[model samples]
Target: GGPRPLPGQEVSVKVLGALEDGGLGERDPRLIFVPGHGDVVQALELGVPTMQPGEVSFFLAAFPYAYGRPGREPDVPPEAPLLFEVTLLEVRDGPDPQSLPPAVRLRLGSQRRERGNFHFARGDFAAALRSYRLSLRALDGPATAPPGPEEEEELREQRVKCLNNCAAAELKLGRAEEALAACEAALRISPDNGRALLRRGQLLAEQGRDAEAALVLRRALELDPASKVIHTELSRLAKRQSPPS
Candidate 1:
């Protein structure tokens, strides 16, 4: 158990919160940010104020520090004992490193890909792909152009988006191998990426790796159980792998 938090600090936690009923409220082993830049509630504010990074706490909260009025939570009840188990992870700075402007200097190609976002969101798929490739080219180690802030952040952001779009386009174009490679690259950089997981599962199923496909699809489902497409894909895979009559 613990108390209070130092201001302007953020920590990741594995949280379990429950309402009046004995039923499980929210269960996720995934890490969550706490004192997370005012994104949480007042009760959370009260409890997390004294906690340090890597500390763990379990406690029941009272009404004043909990759902004080209506519209906060309809079912949690005024007098309910709100149980919580929390683990503080790392404290964060304003933005992630890449999001922060580079201190050293600047370059030209960086300016080019800074505008790539317009092309990407505009659905000019070919143009966006070209732009990301161009940005990556500028940053390729030595014997080429030097990189800059515009270059580095633009490359990081646009390359990720380009990879995702490539996977989608290839899938639409019936090129499963191309889609699979793009999705794999995206997943390597970001393991919990939703689109990559879905795309990879679809590609796996296309290649007749139905069992692997099912696993990927299931994970996607866990992330978003309300997704009809993922649910349908899982059903199709299950039907295909059923025992012979």
Candidate 2:
């Protein structure tokens, strides 16, 4: 699910986009952006509007929203252009909470997750774990009522993220077995979850099970090759398996 962008919000966008072979603008935009405020995209109909700053993203965008339609842009040929490669480095929200919907109350968990991550960044492992767990507990309450299509989809996406984060927190706190369980549970919910697979691989390696770790991490790499952390861990695992000099 794509992240939402609110007004007064600034984000860094890395767009590997094209001019569609013909367009009026001389600019073929590329590089990061503190993107100006914008509306919800059709693709973002189920956006996780609670995205935080500094979170990296990679996505594909469908057009005519991606590019102006026929006669709109002289540079674009308008043969049904599609946009590939989009990265949102940061996402911000409006400061005033009253104007926001009640659903945002359910989004507090994400903010707690962010606090947990912040504590992790500061090397306060104990505090980080507390925050992560609290975040999970907060999100556990059953939905008040059945959600609309867009809302249900958004919640599912958020649920996966929460599970993945809890797993990471568990792993960091030396609860390898607990981490494994959390990751597995996440997989049960979303079998192809790359984050769960990646974390489980790390846990397996910590238990001195290199071969199994390699298998799990390899799958994660296939899903997200840009993960430097996973790549580095897999490299170490590979080196450990090499014959002695």
Candidate 3:
């Protein structure tokens, strides 16, 4: 270990066993990469700091350092004491999350948005909403300096899209109030956003506010005249408002 592994570095290691009496049983060594600051088993975190590369050490870790109560189940039992024979392989630097370049951050946000779209297509609205929120967080840059006009506009557009997606997910979950807020936030960014307007109108109609829905839907149609979905919604609202002969 030329230099001890520092926080935020990536460490490669081999774990020999777990718990007293080698609870993991006799088996080939297991290799894993642990990001120094990443989520990891507590025992490894405690043990790695003291060991140098190519040094093998045995340590007994109590439940707190192991899986603790309500353990991983079918793997580690509740309140199990763990034993580890560890070998540190190598340490490498990890990227500073805050210092990522703007372009890289935007690309990451796009990836998250794509994941959200995949979840949405699969009808997993909850996961889709989480991914959309994560995308927004990724687009939200560090506060050292404000993004320039072009970058600001790009971020704004991404935020609006994520907000619109969030609204769609919320609507599918029967969370009309949350959906309304998301769509409203998106419209504030892009006032003529037809999708946001359409979602807002749909939510209002679902809540039995047909008149308000009709007004919003009309505005949406103005923004997107070719939207057959908006046209159909308007027709349905009109028919409901019409008195039967």
lDDT of 3 by residue, 1-245 (tens): 47777765667777865656556821236454344322344678777876777777887878766655655557777777877778888777855434666666677677778867766765668868877887777787473445678877888898899999998889789898999999999998899888899999988998899999999999999888999999999999999989998
- lDDT, candidate 1, equals 0.60
Can you give the TM-score per candidate against the true fold? Answer: 0.44, 0.48, 0.59
Each model's lDDT comes to 0.60, 0.60, 0.76
Q: Candidate 2's C-alpha lDDT?
A: 0.60
Against the correct fold, how does model 2 do in TM-score? Answer: 0.48
Instruction: Write candidate 2's Cα lDDT for 1-245 as tens digits.
Output: 35466644544444454445532222224332222212222222222234444444433444534433441244545434444344455554433333334266347556767766665664556656666665565455455454567865665666677778777777678787887888887787787788788888888898899999999898899999899999999999989999999
Candidate whose TM-score is highest: 3
The superposed Cα distance between candidate 2 and the true structure at residue 118, in angstroms, equals 3.8
In model 2, the worst 10-residue window by lDDT is 32-41
Record all residue pairs in model 3 with backbone atoms less than 3 Å apart, i.e. clashing.
19-82, 19-83
Prediction RMSDs, each to the true structure: 17.2, 15.1, 9.3
